[model samples]
Target: MKLNTDASVGEEGWIDLGVVACDSAGRVAFSAARRVRAFWPPEVAECKAIHMAVRLAKAQGLANVIIESDSQVVTTRLTTAALYFSDLDTILGDILEICNGFNPISFTHVKRDGNTAAHNLARAVPFGVEQCWENHVPRDVAPYVLMDTLSLD
Candidate 1:
């Protein structure tokens, strides 16, 4: 599956965060993003992405899944619950509940440059496409997406 996150800032400095999920074949499965009424907080945005990813996975009845993200904090929180969720406890609580449904799910940190597909999708949200796909990514990003899967025998 494919998982991605993004942030959008308004004139007032509030930032919207989002996360989207896709299946193995690059089909958009689910997505979630919201504009925070307050100030921009990268940590909160990161958590929002993780929360959406796990929630989508659970909704799709996926098991033994691998979730990918460009944010280290989000990845760490998914794997180890590293951050305290005081103010975001409600949201974090929901994410943790979804995590309980899977057997072998995991979170992996990918370089931001390596996560272009999701980033592109996130940017498209403003245009009303919460998720996007193709038979393949454009030539420019194909290499990055396939890099992890390519190996020399």
Candidate 2:
């Protein structure tokens, strides 16, 4: 399984977050987006997105997953067991706890260009609401998902 996550912080301090999980064949297993009130730094938002994605995967009964993010800092932190001092420590701790629920998980960093589906979902999120899809793609994100699938070629 592969999960891609992204977040966008609005000027008003609202955060729009998105995550999409795909199977080995690149078909979506789950996808979600929400506008959250806790507005944090971009990296923090990115980490939050990852956290939510992992929760979704666990809920879907996935055993192992590769979590990918455009934020290199977050992925790098997840790569090591070493802890660093940061305002995001709590979130990082939660991530570590969540990963333990899975058999084994890996984290990787990708360029923003490589994460179009999640990015588009994040950008398209509605304020104060959440949208979720299971075993299917949302209508608004269908184009982005198609683009993402094409890029896999």
Candidate 3:
């Protein structure tokens, strides 16, 4: 499967954003885009990204999924569930609910350099936009996308 994913955050403030895709066999079958608003905290954003990924995997009918992220907090939370989620309990709850729909899901932490595509997309998220990928992302995010794709190798 060739799952290509990317994300970016705007320069306005501290925002968490991400994108994930699932390929069935050799085809790009499912994709997810997310951009947490300014109100949503980082932890919430992180969990939402994972939730989106898992949901996409389930939607694609994948039994096993290899999820990737640059945020150590998100990775640790998903893997060990040891982090304190006081601020994001609701978001975490939502993520856990989505997780129940998947058969098996895994999380991996990659360096920011490796997760450039998603980071770039997160940065591009507009101020008022919540989460969606209906329009074309900025071309300036290409370099990061390339970097992200290469890192997967």
TM-score of each: 0.66, 0.93, 0.66
Off-target runs (Cα >4 Å) in candidate 2 are: none
Candidate 2 global lDDT: 0.86
**In candidate 1, which residue pairs clash?**
none
Tens digit of lDDT per residue, candidate 2, span 1-153? 889899988878789899989877789998999888885998899989999999888888899899989999899988885577878878988998988988779999999988888988886666778778888767878887777778778
- Tens digits of lDDT, candidate 1, 1-153: 666565555556555555555556554555554554556366566666677667656766777667777877667766786546475556656677788878877788877765655554444444323342334443444453455334211
lDDT of 3 by residue, 48-140 (tens): 666666665566566656677776776777677554548666665666676676557666787767666556665565554545442233466
* Rank order (by TM-score, best first): 2, 3, 1
Per-candidate Cα lDDT values, in order, are: 0.59, 0.86, 0.56
After the best TM-score superposition of candidate 2, give how far the Cα of residue 32 lies from its true spot, in angstroms. 0.3
Superposition error at 57 for model 2 (Å): 0.7
Which of the two, 1 or 2, has more lDDT? Answer: 2
Candidate 3's C-alpha runs over 4 A off are: 1-16, 22-32, 83-85, 125-127, 130-145
- Residue 134's lDDT in candidate 3: 26
**What lDDT score goes with residue 92 in model 3?**
58
Candidate 1: lDDT of 2? Answer: 60
